[model samples]
Target: MSQQARIDVISGAYGRANRKIEFPKNASGKHESMSDIFGTNVFSIKKMAKSLPKPVFENFRQQLKGGHTLDKVTADAIAHAAKVWALEHNATHFTHWFQPLNDTTAEKHDSFLSLKTTFDNGLAEISALETFSGSELCQSEPDASSFPSGGMRTTFEARGYTVWDTKSPMFIQDGPHGTRVLYVPSVFISYNGEALDEKTVLLRSSSVISKAALDILNLIEPASEDHPRAQNIYTTLGTEQEYFLVDRGLYALRPDLKTTGRTLIGSLPARHQQLEDHYFGKIPTRVLAAMSEVELELAKLGVPIKTRHNEVAPCQFEAAPIFEEAMLAVDHNLITMDVMHRVAHKYKLKCLFHEKPFKGVNGSGKHCNWSLSTDRGENLLSPSSTPETNYRFLLFLVAVLKGVMDHGDLLRTTAASSSNDHRLGAQEAPPAIISVFLGSELTEVLDAIEENRAVDRAVAGTTTTQMRVQGTTLDLKVATLPKLNRDMTDRNRTSPFAFTGNKFEFRAVGSKQSPAFPVTVLNSAVASALLEIKEDLLKQMGDKAVASEEDILAVIRKYITLTKKVRFEGDNYAEEWVKEAEKRGLPNIVKSPEAFKRILAPNNAEMLTRLGVFTQAELESRFHIMNEKYAKEIIIEAQTLWGLLVQHVLPAAFSYRRELSESAAALKQIGAEAAPEMKWLAQLSPLCSDLEDISEELDQLLNEQAPIEDPEKAAEHACYKISPAIEKARELCDKVERLVADKYWPLPKYHEMFSTL
Candidate 1:
């Protein structure tokens, strides 16, 4: 049948009027005392200091801030204090929370309900010291087999250990039913010492970056009379989270959405984002209430969510927190996602973070804003005015350029995902190609350094930097330098990595993904690059008797020349860019499996291992894990399509065709012209035929159980085989939708689902 006829039938399928529900304006304001309720459940530093002995508290603080190893005695004392604080906050249960191979946080809660007997032979109480200990905090065993271990463990080997992560602090989370719970962030590992969790690798990567940063700082500013107080380097990050909030009633009616967290089959709604009024328009009353509740909940947990705004898409919105330590930022982002879902339910909304939840519209992404900072509170990525500032900025900037250039494949791997594949390279999102967008100001600096031109320090806001392409000047202007207060260049949505003032916003992260993997990759890659720069600088300055400042500047200039290929100032989505990127030798890894395969390459593994981010085994495990995830996702999607076709679409098509045939026969018996009914039957006949053919093919594919021996091949088949089946099914279902009568159609139409909101 024609596509238009099928669409018309599907459009008339749903006749019932949707029930409208009103949301409370002050649903989030139930707990009015913000300060009193905020962090009341948390075992915070303030709570710790108050609960523990002065000496024990001081020792534990040193361990947390200085990264010192806590002796067994100190660990015991710390645990005792933590138990007291948790109990005081009404936390009856404690959980060792960790991020496992699934890339989502997990926890196994244990109630503090030890059996106790008093002298009078009655059950009594246990002291705080008796309740908590180092051994208990150090390790825990959860069911490992239930998680995706990538063939690392079997059902019989259900042993997984959670080890305390001394760096991240313990906190409390408030859940439904007024339960206050204590949460300890930790790392999960197997019996053989293989890293079995995302947190373990991320923590290791952070340590590597911190060390490398310190080394670079020391090399640039050696300990001398003038240059004293060199300290540890730290990384800062902020994550911009985008999500869609649909009415819960509409969401519940859609089986595909209920199962897959996205729509599997739905034609475009006429008013969906096409009007463009929803982008930064007045927030809908229901959505605003939902956002308010989410914000209030997150703030109580100390998430520091500073910005909330309407995103480009219709029902989509974005929230961002103030920059914090990179690891903490990652934790906050995870917590925020959880909070969003929880509060969404309270406001009768469903928050969708799937990258492309709705096709034919903008997808969501988590823009990871990353930067480097010195212990002395200076942002290393921020450019300075004086020669000293300029030299330091250029040096760090070049380090980043070199990092991205050398590990472009790794960067691509960092963002590879099945959901993201549909978003990337589209006009509204970043392209698959990895390149750095250093605005006109910094681009000129790199060009000048490459050609040994005198550094331009004049206040000429519009000075043009000339290029030597057949004596053709590129007319690159040093436009009015945005002030420190206004440092961010205009955001380029199409650029995968863009410099936004003091940090690089990695815009390629899929919305549903945990930022841990990509952030860890970024930290590890930059650390390795900085280590190389430090070594090269040391080699070049040996016994030169040159000024330290001048030598540092010279080294930065040299580094710029070597790492300039990664920088771009124009549209990354342009066809011209595809050709230019190829000429520059950048890897354009378009598929998740292919991109993930790079993780196990010899050099990539070597670099990661050297930086202590991952062992060779750990790296191989991740490669297996990502490929397995991709394959499984495709399999699930394919299975969903198969079910929808067999149980829903095909049956509905046949039933509709039978009704059309009966109606045409009735008209002919009445001795009346049945042209309209005949035409309808003609359309229904072809649709029924097409649906049968597609359904048969889908059944054959499912029954054949195509040989998928390896994860990569399985994922490839999913992309090529399973995805097309889904597309074909959707096309047939949409066609049948337009022909079938409203009472006969089983699923809700797009107009009823989207327009009702």
Candidate 2:
């Protein structure tokens, strides 16, 4: 494109962004009360009660809570009631929504209209009527061969099933032109029932963890006739989603952003998040409008969204939901991402969930705040007033530490992706090394416990620590622990996994990823750890009916000492920590290719298979699939950068250079000085030449890597060869972008794209 055309596009984007935004509304003009709007679109318990018979409703409720298989009769009743409730809300079709092997949601819609042949006066006639059968709701067949199966299914093997996930609530999703569809959360599987999707493994992991936790609970505190114990336990998650917003018009003009979900080549703005003023600053009007609609839509879908605020980067924002069971929370988070994107489009803004959408700024991450709970509403990770005395909590905490210590390498693989590679190890985000950060308070308690010594609760001759906040002395002393705040000491945002108050935040999860994978890995690892602790305690007790507290404490101390290397309470981003982590024998697997390769390591595979979280075939398939995905993503980004450079950047730079040369010649012919034009020419020539050379090198590298047949080898090539070349190309492009005049720059400038909104 020519300089003039580029200028025209930039101006058009500005005009579109400046236009008044007309906010969308539902059938009702304005939003009602929060309580009124909440769960309006969901088929909640109230809707079920109103639609189903009392006995069926109670049975179905029990089945859902227990995660048991629904009988045919119960399935039919629930399906019929769901159909009725959906119809009442103007839904005409239903879909079995499931997360595919890819980290995104997929759905195939079917109209509720069923054609039946009825004889009228002995004549066969076809009539259409609304119908949804139990079989239809229970199972759906979509083409499995088309999805990423990693040699699990061939092209001829097309059968795949999506079974309704009873634990996750069904909801109605609105579409264009008043179209509403009932979405039943389901699990996708191959024909033979080998685990094929994320939800299946996640469900398996949840069950294993629950059973393991119950075993430990029974061991620690024996249940008798007087006190019956809870039957099951489950993990909970609250995902903090961070993303960026840019004008849709500007997004449309940028080829790299359109193709790669990130800006492949753009110079940093004069000021971008450097002042740290965008963090918690007053939100821009257009962004707030989009956010309001997004929250309302999510609330209606029963997504319990509870927080929203500006992030550390300009144009970046975050939205978080309250904690829910791991399975339901995963579904809700996927729904939240969809809603945010749709609502942002309604406001003429493009919501970007890419881990690193822009260069030289804080990247986005979905901090998975995870915890464990019992059926009786006990938070296993929550420390009571005196954590030193809470042996049960200490045991559970040690289980988590053992999980991370044993499988930290595998946990690091959960967040591995080509897109996330750019964000990890950056200044803002956590490093690839997996380390657990327990605050100073808990660290001290654990150290004392390991040494078999009582905690020195009193500091400076007092057990209470008073904190002064703006001349207001907030009494923080709540007991031995001082009622640990969200950040117990200084906030350790640099830790990949940090224990914050009642939960451990897995902060390394990429923003765009489904939390099911990471949470599954976590749950499975912790279950294995918990079972090990239980075995150790049992062996120590020998034939004794009840274990002594000393035995339990000994087992806990053994774990704390064994997993000591995985604990780091200091700055994770510091250079010293990296060297120290190496000395401590922790695996600092930074490259995603290496991390993905370790997924099927003997220890990881054995633990997962032993716990029944994943079969050998499923784990092997994942290893293949992740490598294939990583390689493909990098190649696509490389191709996008090359295209932008060839089709957009180079042409614009050459055109501007020619124009400058012509202007200088004209001035020289008129007997005038052309120093400014000559200076631009001198600065522009070298950058453009170097960019052209790098683009050729990138093209050659892609051609060389095109013939690699093995996914693992291809991934390594992409990571080492293509990835670094892409970075070099990016640097050159950024330099050329800066030298090129604003009007002549092919893509919208960073300052313009960010500030236009």
Candidate 3:
């Protein structure tokens, strides 16, 4: 049969199989009482206002919006309302859902049911006071020592606590097997008040950015006829998620995929992405069914997933959503990832979000498209009609450029991870070096501004046109190209950071990571830049005589000059570019530990602390947390490699060697020249030798696992010592996979996983 015929047959079989799977219908129509249903399963502001007394509700709302602390009385009232809401939703349990130092969400559930006797009859009742008390919302004990702590906590200090976060909403999660619970988004911390979770740090960072953005807006366009009271500005994020789906049975057969979330050893399939047929190709029946289920589940939770299509890599796909407030978007992304796993399983598929699930093929990445916007619905990053005209827009643009230039290392650290280490600098993934792609128009504008030359208004309005011939009809219509807008910049696949239309798309984020970390870092850095610009502008304009629009423009022009070195529109992945970046004195901290060290630098520590984005202690804790996580991930990968070699590869190779020996003997006994069989044995012998060498290396790495005392040193050791050994083992195993008989190979091949679906 032809290849196309075989594909059609496979596709048809999958379509037929999908007919047996039952998917959930949209629940919007079934549930009436829309007003009540809005947050029927959530402990929302409306529920709290109704359940709590008027005075108590007002006090709680003040605390929620004003970022003030909740007193004991207010806490008790809020908890009472939350308990009633959870009970109404059929939730018997509650959990403090927090982001831990491990870079993943964590929770510990406790039942709300308590046995109590009523005056007239024996009955169980949950008290409003108990649910609303400060004690309940403040903290819960968990084993902190087991999580990555970067030497902050030892095995003896196992106590960790989670505190309720008022900024994010509390919602109920419905699960199978009669499990229904309310979850409060919270921040985790050690007993000593040191942050032990990503949420705490992220919350701090968000505040810093918010304040800085407000200050910049106030300075650029302070209350005027066109503008009323100064509006609050917020950082927005739209993370485009990419992943792969393979048959669950095939996925389970591979040890590496099961343990590490990526294939540690695999050879590329012959037909992988060669035809480019899979890129935006027709969706397979089984995959469409799985995606439909995922979208429905995500939509119910208000995820707003807007785009879905096939990606460059076969079996790989992408999903994107419209931009939302950074913090809320991060929360939604976490929920979306969890839902994707559940939905994929229903279709007998497994979703692989790891950055590089397969070697020698395109890896997945989460492109965090970010922008800054005002509460009045204005995108601050957007270029206005007049480049030499829009004074406010120019000020904001210069502030972002300055921030990215001054704190490139901080941005690099945000996207650093063990798995990401393999994905970056390969395929279409961005290189580790951080640079901005502002296209030709913006570059020219900045140059003209620096040279004190007036940028022509007509040049900014000029548009590009392309001749189109559709079905023998020629049309010359005005398409309104990106023009002087930042989107006009050609996208650089190799640059970690690039300006895409009205937002900056951070291409360095890893597939498996929570967008919270990178977005937080970005917000904080940009806030710091805005603060600096505001201070300088205020200083220059303090004299009422000089407080003109030109002064603001002058200050922005100065910023352009200062941040020039950080802007690069060239090839970031090229060796020449690397040399140029080094010559320009930019820090190229590649490894996680090296990049993380910048977080603790004196300038960064003081800047974040003064901005109130992170306390000194919180900043230090994050540095330790990141380093520890990197080390532990490498350790897990190393151990997993050792297991695959001993239990799977060695046994498979020995079995094949025995078969070769038996075949050679049989040929000699038949009085036939066994040269062909002998040559085959010769090829098998070297493979056996390489496998033994790999096994020995893995064993050596495992046996010499001496714990490092220093956090920095430990992370460094993992990157340099442990990672190389793991790579070597993978090399030998991949070789053995190609030579070993398919029946005796022990594990599923890459072709089976990548091509089967």
lDDT of each: 0.77, 0.88, 0.77
- The number of the candidate with the highest TM-score is 2
lDDT of 3 by residue, 127-168 (tens): 442243457866678888877665678999998888888867
Tens-digit per-residue lDDT, 255-310, candidate 2:
88888899998899889888989999999888887888888788789999999999
Candidate 3: residue pairs that collide: 76-132, 79-132, 439-489
TM-score of every prediction relative to native: 0.89, 0.94, 0.89
What TM-score quantifies how close candidate 1 is to the native fold? 0.89
Q: What TM-score number comes out for model 3?
A: 0.89
| RMSD of every prediction | 5.8, 3.6, 5.2
Off by over 4 Å in 3: 1-16, 19-56, 72-74, 118-139, 156-158, 456-487
Model 2 misplaced stretches (Cα beyond 4 Å): 1-31, 65-68, 224-227, 458-462, 465-488
For candidate 1, lDDT tens digit of each residue in 1-757? 2334434433442332322433223456653554554655456788778877898788888887775767788788778888877777677888898888775789988887675544445756554433877778777888777776777777888887888887677888877787878788888888677788878788888888888888777666656777664566778999999998876666766678877777778777667777777778777666776777777777667778888888887778999989988888888899999989987777666889889877778899999999998777889887654322377777888888888888878988988988888889877788989999976556666666666775453321223353211211233355575423223245677889988767899999988888988889888888988898888778777975333876786788787878778888789988999899999898888878778888987778889988878888778778888888887887777677777777777777677778877887888899878788778878888887887787788777656535676877777777777778878878877877777776666666666555433
lDDT of 3: 0.77
Candidate with better lDDT, 2 vs 3: 2
